[model samples]
Target: MALFSIQDICKSYPGVQAAQNVSFEIDEGEIVGFLGKNGAGKSTIIRILAGVEQPDSGTISMYEAPCTFTMAKQAADAGIAVVHQELNDVPLLTVAENMAMGLGYPKKAGILDRRALNARARAALAELHMDVDPNALVGELSVAERRMVMIARALLTDAKLIVLDEPTASLTEREIEELFAVIKRLKSQDVSFLYVSHRLKEITELCDRSLVMRDGHLVADVQMKEIDEDALVALIAGKRKESLTSKRAERTFGDEVLRVEGLDPFYRGSPFDLHVAAGEILGLAGLGGAGRTETIRQILGANPNLGVTCTLNGRNVQITSPKQAWDCGIGLVPEDRRNEGALLNFPITHNITLSSLKLRRSRNWLPFPSTGKEAREAEHQITTLNLKTPSAEESLANLSGGNQQKAILARSLSAGCKVLILDEPTHGVDVDAKTEIYSQIMRLAASGCAIILISSELPELIELADRFMVLSEGKLVASLNGEVSENELLKLCLTANSEMVA
Candidate 1:
């Protein structure tokens, strides 16, 4: 008998079927990969399983005995826990407190047991080889650290079936290996995992079998060894697709568009100098806390003016804030889209026009945005990017994770930025969406838009970037001109960080 099972699950929204007749089961100690494109009903099915949403009609069973969950707590009681792709963390709370959210507070003598909470949370983090302080505020942790914190919180529970959605979208090579080791160790104790990720490589590495969904339907289910990554892509896409690496072209670039000097004082050698050309894709490679995102943040003027000299298009400019960076023709698609990029309550029109509100005005002198102009501009980007949304009036929160990411990218496009910085731009998106995004990036580069891309996936860099800059602990370690193997790049980054830690 299967350990946990859901049969004929169905769900629907206003205009989307969401999920249709989805059926799957997980055996004891099994790790099943739930593979699907964004909005393909995977999230819906997971939500129903987590008891966040009730299926229109279906049966859930454990050990062949039927059960139903009407609330998230019910699912928790039944040993079902979900770590969603979009993190559910309280920024103001400490790491231990966040980890204790649903696990219940430890109490002794009618008072909160703070020491017990920290000890438990610290143990969980250590299992994943994370070095985060349990008493540190969640908001102060790096994005990768926050991701690990969420995973650790889920582990703190005594879950029988743990569903990890894009669990490694932010982790580095070292962290991912540590997590996989922990998962394998847990599996020996009969723990089951529903591993969800867009990185097919992880699916191949960690999952025993796979379930593929497309257009709200569970289209294919197969053993991992029986199907290759290309076949998996074909199944999820509902059509055969060319290999992404085959799309690579010769390195090309125009004039240098941006230049920076003295950004990092850690280098005792020559002063750190960085530059990206008008039509170049510069891939910034690093481990977590490796200063990949921080470098870009400094360029965008998020930190204090730290003796960092920046020159844009051959002219020196001072960027004092993110808005100032955008005003000066630099647009950023942040790594954490849910919290940093999107306005969940706002319409797609407003969100898309956020960075380039001036472009949506009826006239150049208009102080207020023109509604018609904004709608038209937003619609253009929606169509151009193939953003799957009901309408421009739809709230950004309502769309799937990939569509929300696309909308944020559209905002950068609307800004008509001269230099664009994409930090994990395709973090949680689907494979087809990844291809489209890659195409759009190449098109932008061809159109003379200087791109500084930060991707955790080394293959993406190998496939699209004209060059690569590896960072380790706020220091420049290596710079590869082109065509570097994934293992080689990973080794370069890992070796640097390992040496730094020592």
Candidate 2:
């Protein structure tokens, strides 16, 4: 008998059919990879299975016994746990306190048992070989550590089935290795897993079997050994994607549009310099935590005390805030779009026009906004970006991940900035969406937008950038012009990391 299963689950919202007859099962100790394009109904079905959402139709079975989950707690009580992509945690609380949430704190004679609570948290962390202080504040933990903490908290429930959504979105290579090790170890102990990720390589590495979702339907179920990454990508996209590279033959750049000098992205690290000309894409290449995003932040006015000099269009400027950065004709599409860049619950029109509201206002100081103007511009951007949505008034959260990203990009584009910084722009989208985004980026650069693109995928950089800058430990390790290979970039990063550690 299967350890857990959901049969013929169906869910709908407004005009969106989130899940249409989705059915799947996990055997004891099996690791299943869930693959789909954005808005293909992968997450919707997962939510139903994990009790985060109630299916309009369908049934769940555990050990061949029918069951229902109207609330998340009911699923938890049934030994099921879900770790969402965007973590929901209280930063002010300590690691132990955060882990103890929902689950009651340890107590003795009606008094909280702090030692026992810490011990329990420590034990859960130890399961993943995480060396974190249980009493340490969650706010101070790195993203990688915070993810591990969430996983640890889930395990505390003695979960029989675990659902992980984009578990490695922002993790370093080493952190990913540790996580996979823990997953394998847990699987050996008879723990079942449903893993969701856009990176097909990770699916190839860890998943025993794969399930593909398309248009809110369960499309295919195949053993991992029987399918290659290319075939898997094709199955998810419903079509093969050409190489994600610009089709332009030659590129021409104008005068220098943005430059940074003597900026230190890392604490007490050597200062570095960077510049981007109009109509150029400068790719910043590095492994996770190699200061690519940090460097971009510094240029956008992080750590002003470091005496970093930022020059735009040949004039020196002091930018201390994101608002100021925009005022100076600079824009950033942040890596963490959900938290930093997107307004999920709002309408697409609002999100698309948010950064450029000044353009819609009758006057700079006027509270009155031109809704008609905003909608027109939003529609224009939507059509230009090929964003798939019923209308501009549709709520952003209702759209797929790729469309949400498109809305964010539209926000940046409408802002009419000269220098644009894109951090991990294609992090968690399908091949089709990624290709669309790449084409839009190329078009933007052709229209004279100076671009600084940061991507973990070396092939993206090799194909997109006119030149690439490599940073390691916050230092400029290499500046490669002309052609470069993915292996070369990876080797440089690994070798630089080893040398620095030594």
Candidate 3:
């Protein structure tokens, strides 16, 4: 008998049929890949399995016994644990407290035993080789560390199956390797995993069998060894899509539109100088903590203390704040879309026109937001970006992750930016969404917008970037033009104290 099984699961939300007769099974000690595009019923099924949502008609069986799970606690009692894409830890609490949540705290005679709790948290984290302090607040930990805590918490449960949703979206390459090692160790002990991710490479490397979903149905179930990356992409995308490398072509460059110099002095490294021409996409390549994000922050005036010189369109500009950067025709689609990009509570119209509210005003004298104009602009953006929404008035939180990302991109472009900075634009989106984003970016570049693309995926950078600037330990180590291989980029990212090139 299979360890866990879902048969004929059906779920619907308002006008959307999220899942339709979905069925799958995971054998004991197997890591199954759950592959699908955004809004393709993957999240719906996962939620149903976790008991966060109930299916209209379905049967879930564990160990060949029919199970009924109406709440998260019930699911947990049934030996099911889930680590969602959006973290569930309380930010104000310490690591130990967050881990002990839902699970009772260690207590003696109705008193909380702090020492015991800390010891347990430490033991749990140590199992994953996570070097986090139990007393450290969850808000203070980095994204990768926080993820480790979530995984550790899952392991602490009496769960036979763990569902990991986009577990490596925020992890660095080294951190990802460590996570894989931990997963392998758990699998040895007979823990099954339902690994959901948009990254085909991760699926290929880790999963034993792959299940593909599209349009609220299970489309394909194939053995890992029987399929390649191209086949996987085709399965998720419905039809065979062109390779990302096929989109590469000879890009035309224009006059210098943005320049950065002398940021390294504040970062305590060699001097940094760079220039981006109009209609050009400059790729910034580096590993985590390699100064790529810092460089972009300095250019956007997000790091005010960083003494950096910037020039726009041959004119020296002093950008001391994000507002100043916006006024200078610069906009950044930040890496953390949940925290920095979109207001989840707001409607799509508000998010799309948020950065350019001044342009939506009816008149200068009144100085009030014009709802009609905002809606019109939002509609245009929705059409242009292919944002899937019922209407502009729909809440941003209601849309899928890919649509939310596109809405954020619309906000960046709505301000009439001349130099657009996209940091991991397609970080959590699926293959189809990624292709759409790439096409939109290419169009933006062709229309005289200078773009700075920063991505941890070296293959994506190698395919899209016209020129590459590699950062290592807060320093610019290499600058190369034309096509480059992923191995060369990874080498540059790992190398320290390389000679700086102009």
Candidate 4:
């Protein structure tokens, strides 16, 4: 018998049919990959299965028995656990307390037993081969570490079915390997898993079978061995070829468009100099904390005023603030879009026009919400980018992971920016969306928009960058153009930090 199954489930929200007759099943000891565009009912189905939300119609069964659950607690008692895309740890609480939420304190006095709680949390971490301190504040952890805590929480519950939504979204290679090892062990223990991810390579590696969803419909359910990346993409996108966006044109660089001279950030570091030419795609490659994002932020005036100076279009400029950088025709798509780029509560239509709302305002400097010009532009963006939202007026947070990313890119491009900086544009986006975004970036570069791309994925930089630079410990260590390889880039990033230490 199937472990758990949803049959012809349907759900609808105001102005959106979030899910329509969506159905899938998991088997014992199987890792099933769930693939879909953002807002294509992935979260809705997960919510229904987790008993966080009820479907408008249809039935769910557990072990061939009809089951009705109205709360997450009930689902947990039924051996189901869900790790959401965002961590739910309490910032003020220690790792142990946050991990043990809802479970009573191990003492009769009602005062928390810190030692026992710490020991349990430590044991969970040790099972995953992690060495984090259980007493550490949840807020003090990195994104990757916080995710590990979440996984540990689920493991402690001893749930039979685990749903992981973008589990490795913020994880490094080693962390991901550790997670896979844990998953493999659980599979052997007859604990089924529903793995949702945007990375196709990982899906193939980790999943036994895969299901693809589109616009709330289960489009395909097949074994992982039967599909290649291209076939999988076409299955999701509905065609092998589409006219939405194409690859960028190859072009020669013009004179220096941006120059950084003796740029010293807030930390103690040696000064460095680098230059970007007109229409050039400058790739900044480095490990997680090698200062690639910091360097770009400093150039775009998002960071504190660095001691060094920079030049834009041959004119010496002081970019002390983000507004100053904008005035100088520089735009940045920050690394953390959820925190820096999009307002989660706002509608897509509003967010798309936010950066350029000033352009549409009258002399009195008041926005005209009813003008419909911004609405038309939003629609244009939706069509041009092939965003899969019900409408632009829908809340941005309602969209799926990939569509939310597209909306962010649309907002950035709407600014009419000259020197554009895209940091990890494809982060958490699905394969179809990744290809579409790459094509869009290339087109932007071909239009004389000097581009600076900061990415940890070496193949991306190697594929799109005209010239690549490596940052190590807040300094530019190697800048190479033409015939660059991923091996060279990784080596530079690894050595850069140690070089600074020396």
Q: Could you tell me every candidate's TM-score relative to the true structure?
A: 0.94, 0.91, 0.91, 0.88
Clashes within 3 Å, all models in order: 0, 0, 0, 2
lDDT of 4 by residue, 113-172 (tens): 788889899999988788889989988876668888998888888888999988887675
TM-score of 2: 0.91
- True-structure Cα RMSD, model 1: 2.7
| Model 3: colliding residue pairs | none
lDDT of model 1, residue 181: 95
* Candidate order (TM-score): 1, 3, 2, 4
Candidate 3 residues 187-245, lDDT tens each? 99999999998888899999999899887899999999999999889888888877653
State each model's CA lDDT, in order.
0.85, 0.84, 0.85, 0.80
Q: Residue 183: error of model 4 in Å? A: 1.9
Best model number under TM-score: 1
lDDT of 2 by residue, 17-105 (tens): 87888888899999999988877887788788778888999999998898898888888888788887667889999999999987889
The 10-residue segment with the lowest total lDDT in model 2: 493-502
